[model samples]
Target chain A: MTTLSLAPNPALRSPPSALRNTLTLARRELRDAVRSRWFLLYTLAFTVLGLAVSFVSAAGTGGSGLSGFGRTTAGLVNLVLLVVPLMALSAGAASIASDRERGMLSYLFSQPMNPSELLLGKFLGLAAALLAAISLGLGSCALILAWKGLRTNPQSMFWLCGLAFMLALGMLSVGMLISTLARRASVAVGTGIFVWLMLVFVSDLALMAGAVALRLRIETLFAASLVNPLQVFKMWSLHAVDANLDVLGPAGLYAVEEYGALLHVMFAGCMVAWVVVPLLLASVVLSRRSPL
Target chain B: MNRLRLLAAVASLLACVPAQATQPDHAAPSADAPTTSTVPTTLGEIGRRVAAAEPGATLVIEPGVYHEHLRLTKPLTIRAGGKVIIDGGGSGDIVEITGPDVTFQGFTVRNTGIDLDKENAAIRVLAPRAVIKDNIVEDVLFGIDLREAPDSLISNNRIGGKALDIARRGDGLRLWRSDRTIVEDNVIHDGRDAILWYSKGVVVRRNTGLDSRYGLHLMFSDDVTITDNEFTRNSVGIYLMYSTGVEIAGNRLIQNRGPSGYGLGLKETDRFVVRGNLMVGNRSGIYIDGSPLAPDVPGEFSANTLAGNDVGITFLPSARGNLIYANNFIDNFNQIAVAGRGNLDANQFWKGDAGNFWSDYTGYDQNHDGVGDFVHESATLFEDLMDREPSLRLFLFSPAQQAVEFVGRAVPAVRPEPKFTDEVPLMRPVPVAALPASSSSTRMPLAAGGAILVLFGSGLLRLVRDPAGGPGGAL
Candidate 1:
């Protein structure tokens, strides 16, 4: 009852796959960053700052008293958390928005590839550059900590690196969204920062104002927290530190008890949303709009 | 004649005993230390002589401003006679008590300036069951700083000062890692934060804190119940962060007006009972901020009056599943605000559909009942456009706010609820603390339960260590 229709031999003449293009782009980006003065400057600045903070903290605790490799590593981890996303955002802003401004995007788009390949390739390139810089900086700090005979929790480093990756991806996605929406690179970067401030700081401030005004229960505060991914990230990070000390109240205990598994799922969901939503939206926009 | 002969015989026996066995030496030397005839010239000499005295001793001080840091490391009483004064003159702490069962009374202690760099205090009590009562501590950084002293009483002290001027100034009656202490009926006025960090089982009652940054600042502390206190003209009535199991009842938060001020600022706090508190004439009332990093802290808020504030209640992004029921939101500028779609599922709003009163409610009660006719869909136009363009928030207080509010209420849009509206909105205001009283403490359970999880993790590690059984079995 079914008619066999003859179609073009797609396997015989297929376009390049996304994974191969993405890797090639990533390699190109890595090479570009290695050749760039900006990348070198960023690495040098972070390294110097890391050393300074370590020295200050160590000196204050009394030099040659207690080796503070753990403390120094914590500081480095904190620095990575703060800096990696910022650098990712910068790279992301340039990925597409700057290429279009320079009129080099049209040529790339005209190549034998789809919009997904172009966008994915661009994202991969930025990620590769950021990861290299992050690993180098973190490794240097880690080496110093090891030399000082400090106990660094491998699990902590694992979680930290994983968190950094997620954050960097989220920031990059946000940047991509901005790049697609805005005509200029500056606007993309500014918008990304604006988003960061809102998620990290303003949301909590607004929630605080509400709780004070309504005199609501602790459950309400917990429910309100689910809307911000930064809170989820922070809660998970703190849980890693000390689960009991995460919240300073019994209400916190109840919330954690009530929504233990759900909280993790929700956090993962938000992280995915923060990444995929913006990137998907950007892709849709990029596909429609002129790359140049 | 018989009674007179008996008295004469007793007197003759007493004289014979002293003459035969040196009875006067034992009785006189022992009794002399308690009530010394000699006065000490120097502070060090006084300490040495006091140390040398017998137990249950009292070293009385004469009139002079003794500029010294006296340390009491033994169980003794230092009672001031007449006008005894010890002044550090902004150099260091006047007295540091580091002994059990020690008592300090009736001295004018002054000028305990906190070196942001040091643990400076007028008196630092580091003993259990110590009594620091009826002392006049003025112009000191901390009137009485207690450290890990349980069952101690710091009462009836007139502690006055220019509250710590530095950003690092802690509580005037600061308790650091202390437990089961009572700070009652004291005047802790004009301090940075009246009762600061790291204390448990503290009952801070009948206290007055005026002209301070925060009336009570509880940080990393638990099981503190502050009641019947008056906090006036302060930046915040109470700023509690990383504090748990705190019951703040029957307190008057009055006239704490300033830029960025609140009646109560609860952040990263859990398991609190905020009842019967009257927050009046503050910029904002009862601000709650969840740690954006750690959101699922359960909290309960009930029966608190928001008499006069710019905004009554606000819930930010990341506050969720909270129960905000049975509260009076009367005559505030704005009643409630929840997050927008930009901030989703961060908070839960319930009982809002039930008849919670709103000043801006234009809906008619067709049945002529006390309840409001319409559910307060409190989405404002300003919030929507602000989510799209946040830079426009600078004009929030401008005349445009009214226009925005008008437009927002007109549109029936859904926003996140603040979790405050009662499931059955009360016909009348419920009294704060009207519920059945329960005395629950916030001591964390023994680590035995957590130890099991550790063992499980260890077991996993052991399994991984055994390569023959672990990896091959899985493969």
Candidate 2:
């Protein structure tokens, strides 16, 4: 972990531009993600889950009589809710924190690039990897379904994949924020997992309990739920498949009635904001703390 | 006033017109070059022919468009020779059959008046034993309004209502006190409802209706048999209100998602058998509101496949005395829900070791028997809360719902009691008669699928076993 071996010697090489440095850093991060075992495992598991969903939906109407529109996608969405954010958080929190722990950030910063570039490059690369994994997993499942001559709607799958990727990006941004704040890799990883658990399970339960106990207004509960991006993902992803969100009850009905056809655009915009805002805050923190 | 001056100028303009231009087309012999009295071209000419005919005579109408309203007072068989059209000039009832035993067949009757107060219809039958068949009644208000026409038949008629607001449009087929009638093979759409008010012994079969209000709405109609009908995209499929001895069988009710989106709404209905129907994609497959209202009579529901509905059976809290067996409740979000907070224990979930097959049934069949080993009880605390506050359904398939379910599982004290217990739930779906094939789905193109397969297949191999070893030491 010596900084001398990676010293920025002016006699050896000229400095590249900021864009080039960022791209180089991005490519490195992408390669790292590609090589990771957990990434591959997640993709494989997603494929298996996709196959199960298709099989369950297509099992059919002879005597089983489970006919009409398939609702097995709900299971897929549930699993996505449980896992996609965790995947993004772990991968993201490890990126910068691990570099800091290995004494690589100091050496890397000694080069021509700035801290903001490094963070942006890492975020972009991780987001790209996440998107690719989501696309391949969902696309392979759809492709398998099409080849099997099953009930495959590519349009619906497209929206779902987009939703999952968008959700992952938001989680990744939050992970970047955690990584920027925490000094140790273990602390960052632990914080990321804790955030995931709180977001995925406990907070929602507490909110529900609090709402019931306090007899909170539906509008209050609805407004409060939107703070959890997972809730937004659920609202919109379920809505993508079934526009009539009767299963979702009143809140879903309100969303449909309030937003109508533009609800998808609203969801996409909200997700984009979720990604951009946290990443900006992380960049500010990183640049201030590690003055290049 | 300026209006009075304009009226005087219009009157002066009318006075300047030639006297010949004011003559009528129905005037005696000036209609055409060869004016044969037998070949009646106008509705007025036909009315003359009908008036001169005997009490029970057959009038074969020539193929042409008659732009006038006509009424038949005596018993007559009016059949079209080829393609007879009776256009009402968009002002009044096209045809009125007041004669007993009159049969109107093989005509395209259209363009009836749009006056709601007059109840303008294409064919308004007021006599008994009339047979109206093989007709195309369109561009009209009320399609075939039958009043006191007993022992009559309306068959093979394609009827469509006027293009107006939904509330402004009239019924496609309205029968009032018309007993012992048969409505068969009619395809109706874009109307308010096909209602049978106080009509008894009416058999409506093989009719296909869509984009309407009610497929077949009945009020106080008894001994009605509605079978082999397909009603899709309607407000309510078949609503039997305050009726007895009705049989709704072999019908397909699909996608009825309007405000009152029930495939069947039985409000205080008694002695009904709902059998062999396919109820799909409805908000609530069957809304039972105080049904089986008779003290001793129970509603018989059997062998129906209720699939993909939001709630298979939504019962008002007071609904009970229903014998539900041999049905398939599949993939509905909430299979059976009570509208308010009440258990469904009063209704019979099984009868003598025979019960419906539920897709959400967690019980398994041991020893390969047809019946499940454990009793299938369906009442999660979430479902109970949903019944109490329907808005709670918003949490379905969300973490909040799963969190509640987890808590309910960990601590049984907070878990509400089960709604219904199936003592011997069926292991398999009952073999109800097959319905029409599901509507087609647009599949992903082969090229797209191939592209994905090729990209992912090779990309994974190269990426997983990267030749550059240990590149991500920091990660």
Candidate 3:
């Protein structure tokens, strides 16, 4: 019985009561996130990205309305790939690992609350924070585009931001797993950054090289790539604009012709797996390691 | 081989065939009539009239529906009074011209049978010096089939084919062995192709072909000039096979994304020139295979904008002696690709000091010259790999592709020999048509929304000063 005693007992509470506790923790985590420097930095990075988009568009370079809009949005995809993952990874890795580093998680777990509840609560709160950050980022972008009197599509902007948010959610779950496993906060963060680099840079190259070397079937090669969250995000981002996937060349055409509508479902399933499976594994590991 | 019923049609006997009665000159149907013929009649009834009509005689028909197939056996003029409709009853050719110097105009010819083997058409011309203009041909298996008809002028015709599979649809405008023909201002859609087979000295301009199999398919057709034509949303735009002395200029070829999907494809052709053309959003902007088929007859491609294509200017091993300069290759997925195991070293990349502009060219021009200081190479390690294995293109939009290129560049040993290099690559894109600018009307709403979000963000930032500070230091 400690600071944990203030929280409800997990054993005696009904399902609804457990839900209430999870919401309470989620609300507290969200409030804390708002006050955190990480959130501030995350929001700043997105705002800077928005600024870059506007300035580039304002220069009157890309030309025409839709073409200019398309070109700028394509550029935004590359930047979002870098920032979204980094934000989600840092926020998630530090949330549990840093608190556990100070032995605060242990004190909180002194109550009858299950470790899974805390994990789920933190995830939901962090997801909400990232979404808010993304919205503000896109909002700033729209403002600048409109202010410069540049023609743009709101649906495309929303689509790109939505995809970025989904990427952040998936990366955040992986970060939580890293946080759960690594005992030290710095070590967890280091690991998270390394994982980010692997996902962002190394993994795709390796898969491409391996696929070529093995002469793997296109279906198999593409299926293997779906496991990587970044790859999934990249595929979806391209898919949104390119209806027939002509940009990806033969492979894109093959994807559309073969899977048709099922391709989206397959990608969506992989994204959900990235979000849910890692968080569940992290919670299981945390429960086992920090036994009540 | 169709039914031939010839009536002794005289110059003065207007609508004298069968039971058709002639109208008075003042009672002519249309105000746009070129001549003073007082006949509003059926083609089935006037088969004998057409056969017996004197050479160079003018025939005017009333503006009404005529469900009959007619054949022209004399050098006569058959013009519509107004909006004359000729329904072919879905069986045979609607109007077949077998004599030279026939002028057929101002008729809506439709409902040819879907019998490909029979080669049925709305109008089949087997004569020379024919003027076929100002007509609307729809539900046709074949629009206008000109066989051995030279010096013909076909213009201002809208030809729409039947709603059949692309393979089953007949050519919209088929010119076979017809020389020195001028085909212009025709809109042909939903057909197989507008083909010119062995038709030499042909000038095809101002034609628009949409949603067709091939826009203008030239097979063994020499000395052709195709200009100011737009062929979009088709299987292949303008394919020249075994043709020589051809000029393809000022054409807009967009989104020809069929299976082959080449905006402009040339195979075994020589002494060809392509300039001032807009090739955009195609699967491949220009695909060359065995071009410059002759030893010294080089193909010249200049001042064309090939943008937003999946693959631009693909070359086969047999393709050589091509002078490619002053073209803008921009925003393509894969700018240049070799179809098989070969390089494009045989082709000439530049003409003297002027070279083409590459959007991906990274060299800087320090002397303010339009030319890049360094040579531009199309080959990159990532692109090379992607060409070898098409599936590697899946990672093209991802950062991992850049990493591979970075690694390839870092290691000097792994740097590849580009398929072709431009020694005098243009630093700036040659200005084509200026881009249109549009002003956004959502400015006020967007600005207000941005202001609100900024305020919200500022409010959120103020919370960072809270004494709690939280566990963010670890982040």
Ranking by TM-score: 2, 3, 1
Predicted complex 1: CAPRI docking category: incorrect
State the lDDT at A147 in candidate 1: 42
- The DockQ figures for the candidates are 0.02, 0.24, 0.25
lDDT of 1 by residue, B1-475 (tens): 4553443334223211212222222233223222211112346644666667666677787777776667777778887886777777686666777678888888888886566334467777777878887788888765677766777888888877644453455356777666888888887777666654567878889888888777887877788998988788887777777778888888878666543356777776777877777776565576666632244554666666665454565445555545565566654544554322333244443335434434334455566565545544555666555433322332232223334556456755633232343333434444433222342422122122223323433343343234443222221
Q: Give per-residue CA lDDT, model 3, range B147-244, as digits (tens).
A: 88999999999999999987588889988889999999999999988988878999999999999988998888899999999999997899888899
lDDT of 3 at B127: 84
Model 3, range A30-143, lDDT digits (tens) per residue?
Answer: 667887788888788888976886776454332322233544565667677778898899888887888787788887687567898889888987887887787778768767
DockQ of 1: 0.02
Ordering by DockQ: 3, 2, 1
- Relative to the real complex, the DockQ score for model 3 comes to 0.25
Q: Is candidate 1 or candidate 3 better by TM-score?
A: 3
Which runs in model 3 stand beyond 4 Å of their true positions?
A: A1-27, A46-74, A102-118, A136-154, A181-184, A280-292, B1-66, B80-84, B88-92, B433-475
| Model 2 deviation from native, Cα RMSD in Å | 11.4
Sliding window of 10 residues with minimal summed lDDT for model 2 chain B: B29-38
A1-292 per-residue lDDT for model 1 (tens digits)? 0111112223222544555555445444554555567667766676567656555444422222223232343355446544665666666776677677777667667766667777887777666555555545544444444443334344544454456667678778878878877787777777777776665546655665555467555556666765665555555554453332112222334344455556656667877787788789888999999886
How would you encode candidate 2's per-residue C-alpha lDDT over B330-372 as one tens digit per residue?
8887899987677887799888879988887888888788999
Cα lDDT listed for each candidate: 0.58, 0.77, 0.77
